[model samples]
Target: MAISLHWLIALLIFAGWGLGFYMHDLPLSPAKLRYYSWHKWMGVTTFILAFLRAGWLATHPAPRLPRVIPPWQTRTARITHFVLYLLMFLIPLSGWLMSSAKGVPTVYFGVLPLPDLIGKDKALGDFLVQVHKWLAFGLAALVGLHIAAAMKHHFMDRDGLMGRMVPFLKSPRL
Candidate 1:
């Protein structure tokens, strides 16, 4: 369940990020509106998956770092993970709030409408646009860091840390 949620959320985040960058500057039209709707749908789905992932983590817990890893790397990994989880929630909420402020409603998969987080305010909406954008970029960077750390463990350390989540990649030397 944890691994499944991890991959699913990862896919959604990347797709949403790609669509966000693609749709940001297009002239207002039906295609742009459709893309925005799709992006919001992905964000909402990611938000829901993040909650499930957190709940799963609370019950199951992440594996401890390999003892051979330096304490600094361990601390950095933990801090980065916490912040990644935080951005998983914050980015989606910011987008939802921004939509509300812009007088646009988020309809989950074009069906159920989520309640607005705040009353309409153009200035606040403008502010939240930046907030969401920067938060997503932060997420992107951390994701890169996460992947790099995994690769370092798998290839250099041969510690099987990557196998903690992805069993097929467990190093034979472990």
Candidate 2:
């Protein structure tokens, strides 16, 4: 369940990121409006999934670091994971805030109309656009780091660490 949620959220985030970049350059038109709606929908889904993932993690703790791994490495992993979770929650929220401030209603699936977090203000919306963009970049970098670390553990360290999330890589070596 945890791994499923993790991958689902990751997929949505990356998809949204790509869609956002593509849509950003497009001129005002029906296509752009449609893309924006899709992007907002993805953001809302990711936000909800993050909450479920967090709740699952809180109730069911993640696996412990192997003693073979250095203490500092373990600490760094913990910190990175904490921040990643934080970003998962924050990025979508920032987007919602940006939409709200820009006077755009975020209708989840074109059916549910979410209330604005704050009153419409162009200046604040502009600021939040920057905030959301930077937060996305930050999350992307961290995701890269995470993948690198996982590969290191799988190949270099040969610890089968990723096996926790990937069933085929079950950790007999551990």
Candidate 3:
């Protein structure tokens, strides 16, 4: 369940990132509007999934770190995981807040309307746009690090750490 949610959220994050970047430079047009709506909806979906994932993680605590992993690396891993969760929640929220401040309604999948976080305030909206942008880049960086760590565990350490999330993969022998 966790692995499934992880992949789903990852896909949405990357896709939304791409769409957000692409739509930013496009001139006002139907395509741009469509893409923006899709991106916003994806962000909403990501927010929901992240919440569910966090709850699931809370109930099902993460497995013990391999004894072979040094104490420092273990600590770093814990910190990184916590930061990832923080960003996962913050990224979408910042976007929603920015949209709300810009006087835009967030309609999930063009069906469900969400209330605005704040009334129109161009100044606050601009600030939130920057916040959302930076948070997304931070998320991208952390996700890269997370993937690199998983690969290192799977290919170099062969400690079965990656196998915890990817049960189909056979843990390589050291």
Best of the candidates, lDDT: 1
What lDDT tens digits, residue by residue, belong to model 1 across residues 122-151?
Answer: 999999999999999999999999999989
Q: Report the number of clashing residue pairs per model.
A: 0, 0, 0
lDDT (0-100) at residue 131 of candidate 1?
96
User: Candidate 2 on 1-174: residue-level lDDT in tens?
Assistant: 899998999899899999999999899999999999999999999999999999999999988888999999999999999999999889999999999999999999999999999999999999999999999999999999999999888877888788887878854453
Which residue pairs collide, candidate 3?
Answer: none
Flag regions of model 2 displaced more than 4 Å: 170-174
Model 1: pairs clashing at backbone N, Cα or C within 3 Å: none
For model 2, state the Cα shift of residue 126 in Å. 0.5
Model 3, 119: alpha-carbon shift in Å? Answer: 1.0
Residues 1-174, candidate 3: write the lDDT tens digits: 899999999999999999999999999999998998999999989989999999999999877997899999999899999999899889999999999999988988889999998899999999999999999999999999999999998999888889888889988874
